[model samples]
Target: MSDSSTVLKYTPAEMMIVVAARALAGVRTVFVGVGLPNIACNVARYTVAPDLELIYESGVYGAQPARQPLSIGDPTLVTGAISVTSMADLFGLYLQGGLVETALLGGAQIDRYGNLNTTVIGNYDNPKVRLPGSGGACEIAINAQRVFIIMHLKKRAFVEQLDFLTTPGHFHGGTSAQELGIASKGPQLMITDKALFDFENAEREMQLISLYPGVTLDDVVVEIGWQVRVAETLSETAPPTTDEIALVRGRLSSGKQSGGTGEA
Candidate 1:
């Protein structure tokens, strides 16, 4: 097929979703947040990976939405979803009870220790800015079989220690997280706009495995604003395939044409 005639090409954002979705290729259920993870899950369900199941923090499982949901409480999230359960039951029974295979999250501040701070930036009692308080993140992190973090990494957001322990990453370091009363498995992958990182043997530190195309290791280091470790051998991220790109563009175009869900 001619390059122009063939369909499906993913954009950088969609490519990021594709990379995130790749991890869900064989996952049976995913406990997800509402933003990028939501779109990524839908993309996975419709495209490359069909086995990926979505579970909302609101306790909706098997949520099969024709379009992306705006939030955990979006009607489509409840209506199109296969089953809706109580929030407590979803966490206590499904999550903490060991039913979820993966949980995806995003946070404002992530430390080298892998700890997340989504609560506040300044003081706890009287803070400078009171961000949305941590939701079921602590439970999700503690209960899920595995975890995935999708965020645009920057120095300020990636800190030395999160101001507040919104979600446990690693209590200390090197199996200390497990020893520190944390029950769930540590993060499996940390996907950023610049590169992808894998935790170093249960340690809170990340080792660079791959860098996105047109992104250099030095470029990543500069943007990180911290002393992040990169492996001696790093690979370049493969650009999105023509088919993947086309599919994403088609979805975007379709959304625009249909007066799509106006959720950013």
Candidate 2:
């Protein structure tokens, strides 16, 4: 799947889920967020991480959903769960207690330091769009061992500064979470339709690590609000294989592109 023509066979949304699913190759437990993240975890369970334990916000731990769940509260997640606890116990014992290995999250906007905004799109007091505000995402970002975020590349979505900081990515800068005495390693990976990124730098900025098979440097740069940094040894992401595409499509009923930058 190295050829751009081959990658074009699948929509960018399918590519994102395939890549996101592959990212959990060795991950054991994942705090699965809604939508794309949920589908990705299920794909991982069938592919890369067969023993992957999915933890949902609605108190279902070690979930084995038969089909793609509509939301965190979807009944499918609870049917085969290892254990279902109270929301308070789930958050306090697993997330905040530092048992979660990784979390897959999504947001409307993300800045250089990886700060997220899922609140008001404009001014909080007077907003243009009132998005679904943070519901456990704030705690997930701060408490999960690390986070993997998924979003399509877009100018306003990848902003210079978030309208309202909902989750702590890297915070002020590198090791800032440690400076603030937070134990979670914060965001380790971010998957986009056009590229993959990591914060493995002195400043912990969202550094581009690889481009999708058909995407180019200019393609990624034009979508971000700030001067995006590319990895010194950048490479193309492996395009989705036939089996991987089948699995992704099987999990995502619509196979639609992820929501674009949340009205940004």
Candidate 3:
């Protein structure tokens, strides 16, 4: 296929990586959770940013792998990863000490205040549904110097109030999350499939910073359930290039060969 003809078809997963990678580029170290964060971090490491440091909640620090890890607790994460230490020290010493500068976590529900919920969907007493539950998300979000959350914004997920606040809302509408003792402060950026958003000050309300490639600002507003404030001057998030597509595909293929589905 001609290079010009190859319009990189970025999967939803790849789009997730594109947005998440851009978010992590300047960050030196990240306390990454599984799923999208893992893929995005690895993508950044392989493509644009090589100096990225990964500190898994599993206690592996500075671990860099050639391909996307199958899971957060995957043996591959520990096998070649360096500074493998006790899970206790990893959190107590490394995370608590603020050694981790950034964190990437997912959410079942996120409010305008940047608070996350990964516990139950319905009422606390008689919940309609129970999620996988928070592993190290609460701790990582609280302790990391900065936090990043990836959740597609939809009516079901974005609610006015969470039935249960799984992780502490670091910052409220006008409070500093760090001062509130919730650790990492509120989310620095919330990357959705439709658009990108960043919080304004301690208000903790997400402001539309940019739209994903091939997505319009209007589309973002229409898709989100709540009112979304857009930046006066927004920029289009650069889409994955052909080179990026090839690299990502090659890595994912290698992962399949090494016993991974590379599903996400």
Clashing pairs in 1: 8-242, 8-243, 8-246, 8-247, 9-244, 9-245, 9-246, 9-247, 10-244, 10-245
Which residue pairs clash within candidate 2?
none
Return the TM-score for each candidate structure.
0.87, 0.91, 0.87
Clashing pairs in model 3, backbone N/Cα/C closer than 3 A: 142-183, 142-184, 170-177
Candidate that scores best on lDDT: 2
lDDT of 2: 0.83
* Regions of model 2 farther than 4 Å from truth: 1-8, 251-264
TM-score of 1: 0.87
Off by over 4 Å in 1: 1-12, 252-264
Best candidate (score: TM-score)? 2
**What is the C-alpha local distance difference test score of each model?**
0.73, 0.83, 0.74
* Cα-based lDDT at residue 195, candidate 1: 84
Candidate 3: clashing residue pairs, number? 3
Give the TM-score comparing model 3 with the true structure, all chains together: 0.87
Q: Tell me which of candidates 1 and 2 scores higher on TM-score.
A: 2
